[model samples]
Target: MRADIHIDSDLLQQCRKGSSKAFRELVEQLKRPAYYHALSLTGHSDDAMDVSQEAFARAWQNMSSYNPSQPFYPWYYTILRRVALNHLRSRSRRREDIDNGQIDTMLTEAGGPGEDCQSVQYSNLVQQALMHLSIEDREILCLKDMHDHSYRELADIVGVPIGTVMSRLYAARQRFRQLMKESGYEHE
Candidate 1:
């Protein structure tokens, strides 16, 4: 784990000791990441803003429940995911289109200037396929593939064993591939 990625243990201890500055500093450090994660998971800008803020509030209100010795994000993630998923469950009956026409950016460099129409179309198809995935699958894919988090980091943030992260990633990718095939995207 990078020393910079986690807020210092001492900082967490200070928060535990009821240091308001430490708490604010912790929230400042985490706010953007938590918001982005919520945004990706919820696929709705407003919901992301709401859920992430709520997660922070809940986490702060229950700070005593957090263990100071461990990495903060993992504990925070539990709160964030619960809130985000609950939001999803409430909206499950009304399915919104997942940003149609947003191209899969991974294809950008791969396609290059020389690769034109077909590549662009393929990228769109892949993105559409991605949109069809379950929120948990999408979150796992984002953490592992998009953000390039290693298995251990994924395990920490996801509150899963490293082995489970690997297995889940494999399953998510497999389902992604299936979706692509269903969407008329043939792997090149």
Candidate 2:
């Protein structure tokens, strides 16, 4: 599920007023979703944790710039996305090599071909295709598809217009479908 929280303006005001407790509450509400989002971007649990924490640290340091009128998570997501992209750039590598052994293990762990096997296989195929996609494509897909962010939320988090979000998400999905086809997996 999307990592959503009702961050009331009073909480933001308290945080802006140097209330450590309030900021901690904010962190507590967001940390899990932030980490999982980071994981989808970074593909490594440790890097995901580090990226999410660093983003939070940056967000806290720049709290004064936050506008109370705007929703908090989208703003926070902007920070997190930048940190994750920066992390990806610095690493200069992508984990695109999910070998057969790993895939076999993953499939085996799901048990023999049952009623849900096709769904499991499709899910794995999509995930594997995502790993091979550009960060931009993966980010857009993950935010829109996986996290269920609306176009407005995506536009805010991506610093783009709503039309741009629509276009980007469409293009990303096209690429994803092509990748899945190339991988010999097709779903209607």
**Residue 113 lDDT (model 1):** 69
lDDT of 2 by residue, 56-144 (tens): 99999999999888888888988999999999888887364433223233223446556376776776786688778887898888788
Deviation from native of the Cα of residue 91 in model 1, angstroms: 2.1
lDDT of each: 0.78, 0.80
Write one digit per residue (lDDT tens) for candidate 1, span 42-151: 76667788999999889888889998768888899889999999988877644455554432433354556677887687777766766678887988987777667789
Off by over 4 Å in 2: 94-117
Clashes by residue pair, model 1: none
- Model 1 global lDDT (CA atoms, 0 to 1): 0.78
Best by lDDT: 2
Residue pairs of candidate 2 with colliding backbone atoms: none
